[model samples]
Target chain A: MLKKRIIPCLDIKDNRTVKGINFENIVDAGDPIELAQRYVLEGADELVFLDITATQEKRKTLTELVRKIAAEINIPFTVGGGINSLEDAKAIIESGADKISVNSAAILNPELITEISKQYGNQCVVVAIDTKFVNGEWMVFRSGGKISTGLKAVDWAKKAADLGAGEILLTSMNNDGTRAGFACEITKQISEAVSIPVIASGGAGTREHFAEVFQETNATGALAASVFHFGQIPIPELKNYLKTQNIPIRI
Target chain B: MIAILKYNAGNVTSVENAVQNLGYSTIVTDDVKALRSADKVIFPGVGEASSAMKYLKEKGLDQVIRALTQPVLGICLGMQLMCDSSEEGETEGLGIFDAKVLKFPATALVPQMGWNNFTSLKGKLFDGINLENDCYFVHSYYAEICPDTVAVTDYILPFSAALQKNNFYATQFHPEKSAKIGLQILNNFLKL
Candidate 1:
């Protein structure tokens, strides 16, 4: 059976991992490669490197950092943030990343998803949709969850799937950094609407929160940043808790 | 010398780079002469089986590859093509290994992409490797475990990770994308 994955997301800026509070007041976490290796040893099922700094200088530095980290880690790693063109995706994939996540670039040109899927297989492309609730409806946000696209979360997810995105990484801005819990309603809706796997991101406080996400939503994986980073919830312990909850895990 | 069979598939450069990183000479070729004369033949592919096999047949490299007696390693789609048949294009395979590559049934999840571990490893390819060490994989179809099964990984079902028959060896995962342990496996195969 395909087990649910536990992913630790690292936001990289200028070759260093920067963790922010509600996407602001960024603080350096340490070297990207060392942090990634630590997550791998802590039983992280996979790693997500989101290069938050979208400048040209940061892009080159991030690419080189991805190469160094890819050379070290044995498990699959995903690189995202400022992936605008096929060349960008190809460069990162060639640098040893197993998959590429696209957000702003994907929304700006939806056809980019199709082109990438055609070139690198659908499995190599992941569409990351950051959603924020507005007027009692979840709307898609771009540029690190700041600019709202006004596109409904479920509709955008369906469109992304139709555009050939293999998986959907749905993050709820309302729940992000709150550590309250996952946006189960949004996650369940999107998961039910798409045939591909859905990874629920944002708002995870405890191990039971993970279990609730798995049980309440049809998500195939759950992603968290501070909870896993600040030692709030250890990955192995969370997996054990999920296992006891009868949720299938890799352990 | 390692000859990585090129068929317009992805990940060819990565494999070639890995070989070069290990201080081994590698040639990315579709030519029959270049492939047959090489010390080791590597069938590296990262695309649909039907289209790739089409290119292989078009160049008449399939016949040349099947005739080679030297050690041959197939990665991802290369491994699927070496089996008896594949459901990808409903196309016949090289029959190098007595196994069939079948598509994963459309369950909750279709493509088993990401890192998965190998167990029950056998043969020289897995030398100095530990069980449960995860390797990167990105595929929908899997080569079923058979008499040639050397290593196994689980997703929707337990499937062959590595398979060996005589001098022919294949892995469903992308060793090139799998980092160090992957490099170790590739190094082991190169040494073989």
Candidate 2:
């Protein structure tokens, strides 16, 4: 049986893990490799690094950081944020990222999804969609969720899959950072709509939240940042919790 | 020394990094001589089959790979190309493994791209790795179970997770991308 994956997301800024900037639980938690190594020891199935770099030079720094971490860790690692073209994707992949995720770029040009997937296999192209419930419907947002794309989340997910996206990283803005759990209703919609795997992101509070998302939706994986970063939810404890709940979590 | 077989397939760089992470130096080369002289040859790829087979034939890597006697590990697409043939391209493979790589039926979600556990492990690859050890797999096609199959993973159906025959061993999953247990698997392969 395919196990439900638990992915700890690291938000990178200027090549350092910034997601843990406010994480007071772990000492010096900003070190990407150290936290990633700890996560591996705790049995994290995979890792995602969201590179929120601002400039081209900083992007280079991010790739260097990717290389540094990839050299130390031996897990599935994905790099996202600011990757818009094949060259960008190639740079990151060469830097040792297993897959590259695109959000606003894919929305602006859906063909970019197919184009990248063709060069690199579809298995390496993850299209992330940020959706917010607006006016009673889940609408897609781009440009760091500041601008609405006016596209339906479920419909765009199907389109992205049609465009050769291997997987969908669906993050619900309404539930993001709220610790209210994942947007299961939309997650199930997209998962059912696409043939590829769907990774549920955004709201992950308790270990039970991970269980709730898995139980309610066919999400292949669940991703969270601060909770795990702050040591509030250690990955091993979460895995054991999920196992007791009858979830097919990786141990 | 490790020679990472290069035929322009993707993931060669990452594999080299993984090898180095395990404290082994590797050279990414298509030269048959470099491959022959290496202590171990790692054949890792991430790409479609038909075209990759085309490139391999054009460069004669297909033959060079088949003639390897030392322990050669094939990963993902590299593992598929080690079979007799692949349904992905209807292209003839190296025939190292008596199996066929077929696309996952449309009835199930393809690529099955994530971490999955292994069962029925009976080889050096799983040494120090638990029976229920999970590895990252990202492929649309899979090599069917054959007499050489040492491990099996059930996704849509039971497929060959790991295959070993004589000096040729291949894993349908990416050990390089599968964390500590994955590193342990590679360490075992290196010791072999």
Candidate 3:
């Protein structure tokens, strides 16, 4: 039985975790390694470190930080953001990352997904798509939701799976940081469209929100940021709640 | 010194790093001489059974590994290859253990990934680790529990988590990826 995963996502920039109210007003959280260790102890199923800074200074810092976190943490961790090429994905995985996630890179060069999957197994490749509803149609976003691509979210997801992406991490730009709930409609659409596991991200505030996402959507996991960071909901308690709800959990 | 038999399987670095963390030097080698002469052999792999067995035969490591008198520990695919046969690739194994590795039914999960508790452990590998302590796993094939099964874990059904027979011991889970309980298992194997 595959257990449903509870992941705490950390947005890294210049070696520090930066969080915003709604993808703006970024505030310093602390060192990524420290926060990672804290989350593990608090029963986080996995961690995702997204290097949001596209600058060279942040890239170097993220590479070194990934190695540091891999050395200290024992659970599976994923590294994403600004990963544009096969070499970037390889470097991160060799540095002890369990998986490498590509967002804009995949949309730009869809072949990169096949190339990376060929070099490293598909299990090591994750394709993340940032989506927002536009005129009753789900659209893909790039550059942290700054640019919108007219590709339908579900179509792109299916194409990613066909290109050998092991998993899909679908984040809703409209609901991100809103803490309202997941964009369950799009999540369900994409999840039903692909054979690979889908991890639902964005807009989770309370434990019930997680339950709603897992139950209402076809997501294999639920990833959040502010709620876990502010200690509003502990992972173990959330798992307990899900367990009572008859959702499969490791505990 | 520990010698981890390296072939085409993945996750070799994780094993090397875990051994190094325990203060033991490790060499990832496919050389039969290095593996045969090492203090202990760690056969680690993550791939299909048939292709991996073909690589071992091509390197003539299949013979060297079977003749090793020192304790040899196999992880994941390594454990499956130590058995008599595997349903994956419809291949034959080393036959060190009287078990057979079979793919999980498609009705069940295709790949059983993530952490699960081990029960009925009976070896040095589970030394300080409790029966219910969880260990990480990621595999589609499993070895049925036999007389050699030292520990068991359940997903769709009961399967061997750890197996031992004389000098050969194997685990179906990735101890190197299993956090504290994983490190403790590695420490116990190092002492052995």
Best by DockQ: 2
Looking at model 3, residue B30 earns an lDDT score of 82
- Each candidate's fnat: 0.33, 0.81, 0.23
**DockQ of predictions, in order shown:** 0.38, 0.77, 0.41
lDDT of 1 by residue, B1-192 (tens): 899987866766567777878889989887778888899999988778888888888888788889999999999999999999999989998999999999998774678866678667888999998776667787899999999999998877889999999999999988876667788999999999
What Cα-based lDDT does every candidate model obtain? 0.86, 0.87, 0.86
Candidate 1 Cα errors over 4 Å, as ranges: A56-58, B1-3, B12-40, B115-136, B144-147, B150-160, B175-192
Q: Evaluate model 1 with DockQ and give the value.
A: 0.38
DockQ of 2: 0.77
Q: What tens-digit string does per-residue lDDT give for candidate 2 at A123-210?
A: 8899999999998999999977879999999999999999989999998988777788899999999998999999999889999999
Return whichever of 1 and 2 wins on TM-score. Answer: 2
Interface RMSD of each: 3.3, 1.3, 2.4
Across residues A1-251, which tens digit of lDDT does each residue of candidate 3 receive?
A: 45688999999888888887656879888788999999887777778999888565566667788888877787788899999888888778877788899999899999999998777667778899999999999999887888888899999999998898888999998899999989999999998788777999999988898889889877888999888887888878998999899887766
Query: TM-scores of the models, in the given order?
Result: 0.87, 0.96, 0.90
Worst 10 residues of 3 chain A by lDDT: A54-63
Question: Taking the tens digit of each residue's C-alpha lDDT, what string does model 1 give over A1-251?
Answer: 45678999998887777888677889987778888888877778778999998675677777788778765676677899899999999888877777899999999999999999999889888999999889999999999888988899999999999999999999998888888999999999999999888999988888988999999988988999888777889888898889899987766
| Local accuracy of candidate 2 as per-residue lDDT tens digits, B1-192 | 999988877867668877887889999998888999999999999888889899999998888888889999999889999999999869988899999998888777898877888767888788777668788888888899999999999888889999999999999998898877778888899889
Docking verdict class for candidate 1: acceptable
Question: After superposition on all CA atoms, what RMSD does each candidate show versus the true structure?
Answer: 3.2, 2.5, 2.6
Candidate 2 Cα lDDT to native: 0.87
